[model samples]
Target chain A: MPRTSDGRERLIEAGVELFSQRPYGSIGVAELCTRAGVNKGSFYYFFASKEALALAVIDRHWTWQKGVWAGILDGSGSLLDRLRGLFDATAQMQVDAVTGTGWVAGCLFGNLALEVSSQNEPVRLRLQEIFDEQIAMIASRLASAVESGELQSVADVDGAAKAIVAQLEGLVLFAKVFNDPSQLDALWQNSLALLGLAPARA
Target chain B: MPRTSDGRERLIEAGVELFSQRPYGSIGVAELCTRAGVNKGSFYYFFASKEALALAVIDRHWTWQKGVWAGILDGSGSLLDRLRGLFDATAQMQVDAVTGTGWVAGCLFGNLALEVSSQNEPVRLRLQEIFDEQIAMIASRLASAVESGELQSVADVDGAAKAIVAQLEGLVLFAKVFNDPSQLDALWQNSLALLGLAPARA
Candidate 1:
């Protein structure tokens, strides 16, 4: 069992699990407190509102997510192989999560984006910032790919990066819909096509 | 102004608008009734529960949406051109909605899928059915394209179709994030790559 000294950490963990797996608006402060194993007073002491907790959750998730991105994306390998590895790593993570939780929980950021981007502007902008940062990271890698002769030079590297992000996010949604992580396998291969490259020999 | 006679139609319309624009759990039956200009009694008189009304809204949107699909997808032209037209038409529809409603309302089925698929089984299955139907439609068109020598023969037509659906849904989510419909354009061009085809010369 994990120690629960930090009320803020507990709330953010609970927020990530509950908000990621279920609808955001349906989650109440009481249920969140119960899940976190922290009382309402502790919850109030840590955060101003549920929305505030959500921002903290996003920040925490992004910090971990950025590390994952750097490991697969920023490490040494052919760029295409690295991108493919990222998708495989992502699907495996989802599989491991299903083994633990008994449900297919898609990308937390994406699930939230679809659910509340229109309704919540602050959350929406935060999500957009995260997406933009990810896109820029991807764009930089693609630019590197162009330099290394791995991917063909493209006029719009940023545009291609955005497409890759969209496709990966879309594949994650499909995985949730089918309740099977393997759906991601077939879809992610198409990302190569976005870069004008043939599918890697699998 | 559109004339509103039927209580059920009004409820369904309101459901389509409200649920599509916002999170599912946040919108209550009272607000739905108020938006539809029908009293609570009439709401229950027409439907058994909010989920049932969601089903009606899905059915109604699919009905109207199929017409739009037919207009763009069923017309006589190169199948590739038709596919491109569907994307343009979809983006235009989003633009028109933004002009009219001041929000980038995305695909209603997709919005609901992200919000309720994990929480609601029946709704999830219903959405899965709609997605399967759309995939089949696209697969059939792809089959036609293969027959006409427009597209290379592929082993998994259905899988490719699902990728297109996923990409388009993903692009719409990005559009909502940026509150700009143009995010769709860059991402959607990659759909051609899904079919192993180059972009059509415009």
Candidate 2:
């Protein structure tokens, strides 16, 4: 038999899965508890309410994603390599043959941003901050490229960085809806071309 | 004392407002019916079920948007003018005043594409088709520009078109989350620059 702490961890795990799979509002505490294989008492012991559990799940997701990005950006590789690594890693997580079936699940942040952010003020502000941080991180990378003379010095580094991230987000949306990884490939190619990093072909 | 037919339109009107304001799952059928000022029987009479009503609302949204695009594309104007006109129209709809409220209700298809598509096959397929049609329309416009030689001949028209639409969608997502229309302005300017059109000076 699992300990009480194990049950709490299971509840958080189930919440993440459910929130990712469906709209947060659609899933109930009872269903989440059932999925976690824990009783209501255990659920209450771990979190104040379903909303608190959701907040915890979101915090965990943000932390994990930040770690992934940090690992990629901190890698001993070219900037282009770091960008590609980020895309490839995200594509793998989002495009699973078993769960994906015929449809891509899109980015968890992107999905939640669309669904919950408008009505949920806290979530909206948090997502905005997260996006700003992401843009800044990408901008820093682009600035490095500019300093290295890989990219034009006159290039609108901030604008270009924003465009790259925007295009990536768009690619995620298209890939999810179209269920085609090639859309992401095109996005990567076009972005590289825009950045003057794509290899020239005869 | 309104006619029964009025009830149907009323329900749809309420649906558009509520669904666009929040997630589909967050809005209850009972609340929707009350907002429409119609009983459950009238609601059922107009639509088979809640899902059916949602489909109807989606169809209505698609039809209205197609009309807007048609008006923009079919106008007797230069491609640049048309593009600017489209951006201006969108900005007008999205910009908020001192009160900080505007038409930045977000895209219904985008919201649903994120939340419902993964779980609902019917909605997914329908949204997918809508997205494909949107991409096709933009591609056709770019094809015209390519023929006119306004854009570089070597440019990949289809890819450019997809990227433009992707940026627009991403811009909308950002606008919704941040409740700021300035992001759309950046997107519009960057898009025009990408297309080699002179961006309107701020």
Query: TM-score, each model?
Result: 0.93, 0.89
Question: How would you encode candidate 2's per-residue C-alpha lDDT over A14-42 as one tens digit per residue?
Answer: 98788877778789999999999998888
Give the best candidate by lDDT. Answer: 1
Q: Kindly give the number of clashing pairs for every candidate.
A: 0, 0
lDDT of each: 0.83, 0.74
Instruction: Highest TM-score: give the candidate number.
Output: 1
- What's the residue-level lDDT of B67 in candidate 1? 82
**Distance from true position, residue B92, model 1, in Å?**
1.2
lDDT of 1 by residue, A9-88 (tens): 88899998898888989999999999988888888888889898998899999999999988999777788788888888
lDDT of 1 at A67: 95
i-RMS for every candidate: 3.3, 4.5
Give me the runs in candidate 1 sitting further than 4 Å from their true place: A1-5, A199-202, B1-5, B153-155, B199-202
Candidate 2 per-residue lDDT, tens place, B1-202, comes to 3448989888888887788777898888899999999988788888887788888788888898898887997687877678767777766666643134443677788888888876777877888889878878877887787788765432666666676778877888888778876777776655654453432121
True contacts kept of each: 0.48, 0.42
lDDT of 1 at B146: 76
lDDT of 1 by residue, B5-71 (tens): 5888899999998987888899899999999999988888888999999999999999898888878
Superposed by TM-score, candidate 1 places the C-alpha of residue A100 at a distance from the truth, in angstroms, of 2.0
DockQ of each: 0.49, 0.44
